[model samples]
Target: MQYPIKKNSLVDETIRTIRQHIRQQTWTLNERIPSEAELVELFGIGRNTIREAIKILAYLGVLDVCQGDGTYVRAVDDFSESIVLLNRASLHDHLETRCLLEIEIARFAARRRNAEDIQNLQALLALREKINPLEDLEEFWIRDRDLHLAIAIASHNQALHATYRYFLSTSYEYTKLFIQDEDLAEPDHPAHETLVAAIISGDENQASAYARALLMPTIQQLEQLSTT
Candidate 1:
């Protein structure tokens, strides 16, 4: 089957179309997905685009690619698989994982942050402050991501920074959904300011505490949501 290519974000559009097909049960669970050549022909895109889309799906556990064999459907729902993953961690587990990484990131950032890192953090915070979460959730999220990534960059530990990004990528959709919940409140801007202050002052303990403070309310809310 042929699919029309859009003018913008071709790879994203392609991925969305393929994901839609899976969700609509165009293909059954455990069924082999169309071959790369077939997908390239179907989507009217290059082989590399098809490969990238397929790789993203496989990474998200929606598809299982076996070399010398073929790619098969692993899950019908991308969002569900994203939050729970194949390992079946609880929602609280996911929140705790984020909390653990971020707290240490704050501490390292406090110890290692340089002048440029501070400037980046301040700029990201300024951008974040201007965003109205109720008005533009997507932009709010993007700024939020930038702010956290700025902190990670301040950490000056390449391995830690990379791991933090990996976790953020996997949890991105879930975090987006959580923030969009009407019952969920916006992030505490004052807490962020305080966290930045601690980092600027090079106070590792205070920075860690502020980071935990920033994350705790959301964690409590998630815990409450899970039970209800």
Candidate 2:
């Protein structure tokens, strides 16, 4: 509320500061934001400028503007608004983004993981391996995603961990699309096993290589699907 406001672009600056406040949890998710009058006073801006900023954020899915009630925080950020398109993006595109996220996650995990992290990852991977995807794809997918999530958590990077956690929910739906359409075989569990081992051993390059190795087959499958 006490942010410095530049004169020329009051609306944009108001929007930016409001977003910062939300990000910092000054205004929490589902919590109603300050009223236009309060915001006008807090920001030293006009009612019109405050209303316009709130309207723009509401459009971006970051805030929910109610009829009689005040505006409320809808999501943590704007990424929630674009999830529909992200889920519908090409299989190759999804895999490409997954590669970028997971590869870095693996490297960070390798460098940052502790004994407890190793133990947790091993347990998740074991549970993942035991579930035959063909028998129970949903259960198998959940376990698989959990193991990757453990690795992301082991990275000890809050921003990266949060981003991956949010992204995985979107990717899971699209991943199911290819698995159903292509009748894909069981995932390369051994490759994942090696990736976990690399992290435990603190070998960053090996961890990253294993992570990429695990995803390469899916990329190739998507390419083949496109060609056919």
Candidate 3:
């Protein structure tokens, strides 16, 4: 049966389906593809659709397509390499989800981390402190995301890492959070410091408490923005 592409055009879903086929041995990474013409017949799709799909997989390092030689699957495991291949959702939604994810992940992470994680957390916080809003907001925003991601990665959970990036790419509010507060150039508490500290110090309860304390203010700010 010809499989239909996912609606909403989410590449994650599309890649997931394609990866499933590869995992089921429906497609072999080391073997040659049946050809563009064959893909058209196999999926009952147009040439461009097949081409784009193949390109997506290729971009994920999951396929190899030599000029004049047919496409072949190279790997078919995870698609975390392709989070940037998004077409669905908005920045606000992404920020909302990201904040929520940290709220949960921080709880478990605070209890499961080590000394190195704490060190990295402190370093990121120091870097954030050096941020002068007299410069462009973009650079500051990048550092902010880096610090949060550093803490999330310290959790050592692959799924959380992947999900965290998904939000990072789409969160406009995250970028806006600092710039909106002109007086507060650098983060006062450095949310990641508190997060990483609690995690590395084996205080799961403190991590969650701090996370709520941290995000609750952002939530209020967002609500104010929405109303105004």
Candidate 4:
């Protein structure tokens, strides 16, 4: 359980070693790996370092940290996970899945959204617009995802919300391919504003239309790319 210390980059080294163990099946899927205290002792590192490393891995979906419960192995290997994601579905597949989920999500959000959900969606929309994608494209994408996630949460369907989040995480890498720097330079995403307005006004049909509108261009470009 002990790993050789690299001294300078304790946190990064710990993270790499933990991932190595997971990849090697030293920790198996769905199994609770170890407690924070045990990991600190096993790694011979400070608790803070171990905690930080675990935090990063949890964010990456390699580990799942439950409050009061031990961290569990959510995935076996990062590289193999990415390979499987690549092989299991194409970008077009991810987009089609998005369309299927989002249309209903928008419809239900429009029907179910309360004051708080509307406030949150509006706030996220404003925050998303402020980000100049030309300067920070990745951050813009994250914010955009957060907004869509908020809309899904507004649907009041826990299963649908969880499923959408799972698919969103899986499709994230492929979603990045749908836009380029030049494409994002101007970034005319006015449909987002209207979509929020539609949800706020409880207009289900309009909300669905705007949701599909937001994605249609990307789908078309993907089609163009696949052809070429």
Candidate 5:
């Protein structure tokens, strides 16, 4: 099926349209995105608009398309945008995303991480431990942020590392915005211990799953509070 070219390309508009559809449950991950023909008909946009939108979503890790195979939702839980939202998002959202991303990546890191990466991660973890539990909130968060950065950098993917770096910066500033979230100020969270153990033991699934479990309660707590 051929899609008509638009007189003026609307890449941003196309993207917005796609996002709305996804958010509205019009399409799902692993399901084919609306065809270019459908998009052209509905939006009266050009083929270039459709193509650009597809390409951008693919970059954002939202949708996947194969040359022979149709496009599919990558994962309903895909958090590329979530990571990009690290800055503007709430502290709770930031924590949830970080825990999920790290644990998943940590599992991969356990299997694929090189010695140098391991060393780097270990050093960062150690540095985190040296900070007094009684330290100021700012200092605690600094070390806390460092631990997340270490894991991402240890993954050794330039794109992943860079994405996480930006997330860290945003999260650091945003975390400072709240003074009442004291639980995260703890110097030793058992989840971090499990994370390190899993990485060292080369158990990716264990690592990622543990990381998710560690943060799940906090997410629930946040939800409960938000409702009230």
Candidate 6:
């Protein structure tokens, strides 16, 4: 039941370790986990860290913490468990998956977008244009994510929108890694303009092609990073 919390990112390390333990079947469904006190001793961490880690697991439906009772493992099938594992995938994998998702989303948006969706996409693009990525990286990153999510929303496929949002949330840290690169300091305004125009024009082929072009540089960079 003892676990060593890594020196870096203690809370995140603890969460990963506990999730691994559950995946390994060291803990079964309905089986109560070690107490907060025990976990404190197990991980050589304070109560707050253990509590926070447990709370996160509970929120993810991996654990059920009952007041006046201990926390129990919740049922998780292979499919559900895979979703949790997706969050742990490498940045390269995340980008690859995102590229595929965006391409399909662009195609769908081109076909199904309405006047309101066009207006929303234009608004986001306008906000994006104001951001100078070199001068304001954080704002640039936020606007970039919002613009892509807006396109996904315009797809009118609720399932695609939901999946895209989930991927954005889970791969956020990795996305930040790419945005911080000096090589990526310049925003691709023309690409964004072209993509939006294509979608608004209902040119699914152009929209999909533009989406791929938009993400291709990031994908290639990640590929190089993986090799080196």
Indicate the worst ten consecutive residues by lDDT in candidate 3.
84-93
Deviation in Å, model 2, residue 145 alpha carbon: 1.0
Per-prediction TM-score: 0.60, 0.66, 0.57, 0.59, 0.56, 0.64
Reference-based lDDT, residue 103, model 3: 73
Name the candidate that leads on TM-score. 2
Query: Which runs of model 4 end up more than 4 angstroms from their true locations?
Result: 1-87, 181-187
Residue clash pairs of candidate 6: none
Better of 1 and 4 by lDDT: 1
RMSD of each: 10.4, 9.6, 6.9, 8.7, 8.0, 5.8
Clashing pairs in model 2, backbone N/Cα/C closer than 3 A? none
Instruction: List, residue by residue over 1-228, the lDDT tens digit for candidate 3.
Output: 667665555455555666788889888868776787776676555677667777888887888898888778898664564454433534334445555788777876776667777787778777876776447667777777777787788778989888777667666454675456653323355565666667778788888777666656655666667799
Our model 1 lands, by Cα RMSD against the true structure, at 10.4
Q: How many pairs collide in each candidate, listed in order?
A: 0, 0, 1, 0, 5, 0
The order of the candidates by lDDT, greatest first, is: 2, 6, 1, 4, 5, 3
Worst 10 residues of 1 by lDDT: 79-88
Instruction: Kindly list the per-residue Cα lDDT of model 1 for residues 1-228, writing each as its tens digit.
Output: 588778588778887888888888887899998899988888788898888888998888889999989999998766544544623655567777888999999999999999999999999999999988768877887888889989999999999999888777666666666667767654578889999999999999999999888767878887887789
lDDT of 5 by residue, 1-228 (tens): 433334554786677667777877779757897677777787777677688888888877788978876787774545655655544677677777766676666766777777887787778777777766445767878887787777776676778778667767776565554434675432246668778778777887887787677667767777788899
Quote model 4's TM-score: 0.59
Tens-digit lDDT string for candidate 2 (1-228)? 455578988888888889889989999999999898888788887899888988898889899999898789998878543686786788789887888999999999999999899999989988988987768879977998899999999999999999899888877676576567655432478888899999999999999998888777778877887899
CA lDDT of 72 in candidate 4? Answer: 96
Order of quality (TM-score): 2, 6, 1, 4, 3, 5
Residue 54 displacement (Å), model 5: 24
Stretches of candidate 3 off by over 4 Å are 1-88, 134-136, 169-174, 181-187, 190-193, 224-228
Q: Candidates' lDDT values, in order?
A: 0.84, 0.86, 0.69, 0.83, 0.71, 0.85
Candidate scoring better on lDDT of 2 and 3? 2
TM-score-superior candidate, 1 or 5: 1
